[model samples]
Target: MSDATLAIEPSGPKPKPIFSRRNIIVYGSLIVICLYYLVPLYVMVVTSLKGMPEIRLGNIFSPPLEITFQPWVKAWAEACTGLNCDGLSRGFWNSVRILIPSVIVSIIIASVNGYALANWRFKGANIFFTILIFGSFIPYQVMLYPIVIILREIGLYGSLTGLVIVHTIFGMPILTLLFRNYFTSVPEELFKAARIDGAGFWGIYFRIMLPMSLPIFVVAMILQVTGIWNDFLFGVVYTKPDTYPMTVQLNNIVNSVQGVKEYNVNMAATIITGLVPLTVYFISGKLFVRGIAAGAVKG
Candidate 1:
């Protein structure tokens, strides 16, 4: 063919546009799903800002004309739980007390276990992991009774230490699984090279694998923090009232059967209690996304 004709020829008649009907439909559906999930959050924010009287009017979607901050103040300081009038602020420190140690201990254990399982092929490693995976499937409720008994026998029940240990135990399986999966996606050659360089197991984990697994580590931290912070059943059953996490206190405030419900306070308390997880997610959201992407790339 002539140079002019060849130059004029289209490149394979051009590919079809990416924004086809199927693509449009899929994206439209996703937008709708996102809106559906966000609606409750929108209602929560609006309702939390409203006074009790506005909430009583029952138009949850409407903006508060009065726009009072009284409910927020009351929910933080004056809401009554039984005869106690102290607000959820009282339990905030308790949640923090439980949250800090639980997250640290659980993450450390999970990272170590995951590294060992992924990099080391010890005897019964697979079996140990298999049991762990199996245990994760068991409902926490089923395990609660036995766990309480065991803690009582060990004289750890009803103590902060006991509750911290409980959170760590429940947190391990999922955390370990997360780390293991992420670690397995890493090339085995890296570990072999480290070993050849005279690095021991802990050295390889600390110096090599752990450094590379920051993304998954962030994800695990987010999961553990949210789970432990929002934990109510464990806190209520395993902890004394004095040591109750905010979720327990929030439940007590909002869940009385015989009294008229304070919907505004209830919403405020729920939001307050949820703020930690929400804040964690908000701040680390970018890190979380990056971590999942990195882990998936390695996989």
Candidate 2:
């Protein structure tokens, strides 16, 4: 036999180079996009650290020559948002009050709705789900006045409770959709076994579904928290100044026409306002990705 006939060839295709054209294009685009977002954030951080004199030097990209945390302190405690000399502290607490109840109530209700829709067949389930799908796409502008009147009639207008209700309602369509899709992806055998064990609705949910639904729940929590925390139009229209949310207060602080604009304080307050959602995303980022992938696969 010839020498070539005795040798074995590799079974699979050869590996591509690490720096292939496709890799270069994808990675280069990603790097550029990262810089696009990260540069502004870098400027905001550096500007927040520098004093007014250094800021006026017109070098926004430059790191602070003399770093000071006074801007953060002022933004937290002393910056005048309006008639009130107090800074973001009031708005921060108000946002928390608004955030917690909104997240809890919305998640609970939406998860239940999703589970029922996915697992429990009913006469009008299709119709109800269709309505919810439409509701998700309805422009908030169209519903604004109607919601205001509804809140006013219920004596919840201009209150945190009213705002909470608004958040919960608006959050419903999307969250319910997310949970429903995720629950639908769950193994039918497990659900059937739970039923065979004489498990009721609540029993199955609490014992079987809830234990496996952590990723979706985290996804829901992060979405609700971000939406409720960053809401401005609702916060402005539904509540008075005393109960204004952090976003509203941030707007007031940034737009105040009363004095020289403190760029440092504005930047500091902006970062502080964004911290919660950013923190939540970073902490549960993996879960969020997993939940999205799981929920999207089946639905």
Candidate 3:
């Protein structure tokens, strides 16, 4: 009986479920962080959906007692910013126009520069890249006047074309570094195979690299789209009043001292201004995460 009792039964308790203490802590932390980030967004939405009387009566953090979309309609169509009663639509369209070109041009230049830096290894490329990267750290304020002067001399000042070029220029350093490091992480075998198949520089990039580096591209797109879309400094510095990008126009509408403040309309305009970038970020969520992870792996 003693010997039989000595044979220990094999009963390992069932493996822990997916919702252990560690899981709870992690999930709880994530939810708190998410709420922290989203609180302002919620406030903006709530405020926008509310009328002026409600905004005056209630805290901004409070949800609207009665939701009305008139604020949105007014913001999009009738809200006046000085003599311009056309609302945010003008700025919205201007931004769309600016955004498309800026994103495309900036991404193209950055990707090419990064690819070249990573793979070409020409004489003094690193030295130039070093200078370029270091240039990024210098405050944009320091270069603003010079850029203005240069743009004026080149006859691109205060124009959308000039703004696009400005975006492309400033965007180069980071994008180049990103693409460079990402390409550096790529297995050199595919490159060699492409070369063996008689692919030239452009051919290799277009045929092999471009197709494979999609996540990195998406990362770059996210970076450029958000950055250029939200940029106020360059847009203000480089564009005429009429050509002002959405961010710049948004600020003008909210802060302009022409009439009594309309909090609801201002908030509505802000939400609309933010929607494009938000959409891009949300839609690119998975790819953005993958891109960031992939980028860090190399550089």
User: Can you list the residue pairs that collide in candidate 3?
Assistant: none
**Whose lDDT is higher: candidate 2's or candidate 3's?**
2
Task: List runs of model 1 lying over 4 Å from the truth.
Answer: 1-24, 295-299
- lDDT (Cα atoms) of all candidates against the true structure: 0.88, 0.94, 0.87
Q: Candidate 3: deviation at residue 85, Å?
A: 1.9
Shift of residue 233 alpha carbon in model 1, Å:
1.6
Instruction: Supply candidate 1's per-residue lDDT for 48.
Output: 83
Model 1 C-alpha lDDT versus the unseen true structure:
0.88
Candidate 3 deviant stretches above 4 angstroms = 1-25, 59-62, 295-299
Worst 10 residues of 3 by lDDT: 1-10
Q: lDDT per residue, candidate 2, 22-59, as tens digits?
A: 99999999999999999999999999999999999899
Write the residue-wise lDDT of candidate 1 on 33-126 in tens digits.
9999999988988898888777888999998787777778888899876666778877888889999999999999998998889889899999
**Higher-ranked by TM-score: 1 or 3:** 3
Clashes of each: 0, 0, 0
CA error at residue 5 for candidate 2, angstroms: 18
Maximum-TM-score candidate: 2
